[model samples]
Target chain A: MFKSSRFPIYYKGHPRMFVKDKPIFWWALKWVHARFIIRELTSVPVAFYAIILILQIRALSLGPEAYANFTNWLKTPLSLSLHVISFLFVIYHSVTWFNLAPKAIVIRIGKNRIPGLVITGLNYVAWAIFSVAIAWLFLNLDNLM
Target chain B: MKKSSEPFWWALFGAGGVISALFIPVILFIQGLAIPLGWIESPNYQHLYQLFGSPVTRLFLLALISLSLLHWAHRFRFTLYDGLQVKHLNVLIAIFCYGGAILGSLAAGYYLWLI
Candidate 1:
């Protein structure tokens, strides 16, 4: 008896079963699901940080005074808080990405596949080295100049 | 069968994920927290300007910004589709996400060139 335009053919005394859409809030109902949701949401903070960097570049293009203003803004509580939240989210993203990398990247040497732990280990090591290199560059920028 | 553009976006997402994971945290810690909080000396304007003036640095920034945005676009598109269950608006979501990333990259390029 239930007939819709999309499903016009209906048997006598038979109605199409109606299934309700899953609510978005369902993701938060379980920790595992929430973690997955959080991982996807990390993109928002990553993109936000990129936009902030773009604005910094724009400030640099303007002149020294403008750049100074921009840096000054960076010192404010609001900027610091935003950056803190973004930093945490980006770190979470990094950890999850590294953990997932082994699954995504399978290496074979003469038909012997590398262990996932080794892949994940290498990712962490590389992350540490890169982080140190960048920190060294920033801390020693004056000396380098 | 028609070619699907999914792979292209997925590739960008993967590259951006690696790049951001490697670089963004330290950069944010230094520029966003350390220098701002006086834990480290903020590089003088002249030094920072000269740093940006280098072609290598400019190229790196361009790559980082562009890839990060592309990564965001790709992931966010899926987030909208699966997370929000707005799969019906697939075409529009794809266009908006990718288009925004492209525009952001162009803007970053323009500003980097200006600098």
Candidate 2:
């Protein structure tokens, strides 16, 4: 039989271990905590972009007049400011995601593990390629069609 | 042990993170910022409609919208659970977050199909 002291089994009336919860004040004041909070907050802007795109598609479905109205709204100062803010937040998210990629992905060949910088570098390269491809497609939509 | 559904959601979060990081920036820049700000010429409605009419474009839009929303759902769920210390309401929060994402995705699909 396993010893109770060694195994630390839970039973009736067992005392639970105590752990301190992270303080809200630390989250507000520390740079590391701020980065973590900001990273999570990026989700708001991402979700916002998704909703905007959905509305855009809906407007497109409504007809040219509706779509034009949506575009005009998009051109407004308020809309422009929101896009600018969200764009900045999204860039931060992207940068943080890429920097963390090396930690998440581990590549190895034989006895050798691929360097983390190499993994991070590849992510950046892929990001650049995708961005360029999307830009090119949009910019040349008329010519391509 | 009972199977946990955590991995399923985690996989979605990871995929969404990658997609948003790589594609969303440029999409937002062009469609949301440059075109609207008059820095880049906006594509005409006819051309945009024609583009959306393609099945490939529709599929891409569906994927982008759905996954990005899912990413938000998963991330926000954790943010609420841990950051806000609302773990006691975990089930309610999970349903609310993921349900919203699914509904938004369905709306996107419906709109895309209409176009």
Candidate 3:
């Protein structure tokens, strides 16, 4: 729903063109832009989590003690809070991304155009399947390992 | 200018965005909420190391890291343009953003592959 502002002519049909320049914080004023700004902000945590994953890999490479310490460090209140916040942000990002997919992709079987909700629903289904698979892996880690 | 390669980058951004959106959150839930908060035991380090060492895991991690970085780059570029109203530095901004993603991705690959 993020949209550009519909700027009005400040001076009515002036011979010298007059433009109404919006403030930099204009995005905060509109609901759509506000959502858009939050979406853009989600990239920070996405990038952070990516780096965290890399660090996990690196800690693993360093061997058991390092990995244990890293894991322990992550359990701290500050880290947990950040994780929860980032998790919320990432989930929001995913839901919005799925919802927006219909805009980017269009499928037509003969004459009937597939509904956007159907497309979004299919994505959610796939996501649910994957989440379960990962959960299964996590739960069975003891046996698998 | 010839037709801007905006669509091409957008496709990459889209792919990255979708992949990260679907995968990252669940992992975050487990690591952030489950394991750390005592909802579940911590994962075995050796097993995790073995997983990380595997070719498939490496490939998945690489894709996750690189593509997500590219996604960030593309989004950040537009955020700067439309949100900040800084339209004059088009070529410079494009290069900086895309270049950073490429460089970060390469670094991720190198570290993941070498160590």
* After superposition, candidate 2 runs with Cα above 4 Å error: A1-16, A19-25
Model 3 scores a C-alpha lDDT of 0.83
Task: Pick the winner on DockQ between candidates 2 and 3.
Answer: 2
- Residue-by-residue lDDT tens digits, candidate 3, B1-115: 7997889999989888988988898888997789988888865776767667789878998999888888888998898887887777878999998898898788778768854
**Candidate 2 vs candidate 3: which has greater TM-score?**
2
TM-score of 2: 0.91
TM-score of the A chain in candidate 3: the value is 0.83
Provide the TM-score, chain A, model 2: 0.83
Name every residue pair that clashes in candidate 3: none
Candidates arranged by lDDT, highest first = 1, 2, 3
Best candidate per DockQ, number? 1
> Best-fitting candidate, measured by lDDT?
1
**Residue A114, candidate 2: C-alpha displacement in angstroms:** 1.9
lDDT of 2 at A113: 93
DockQ of 3: 0.59
Q: Report the candidate with higher lDDT, 2 versus 3.
A: 2
Tell me the TM-score of candidate 1's A chain: 0.86
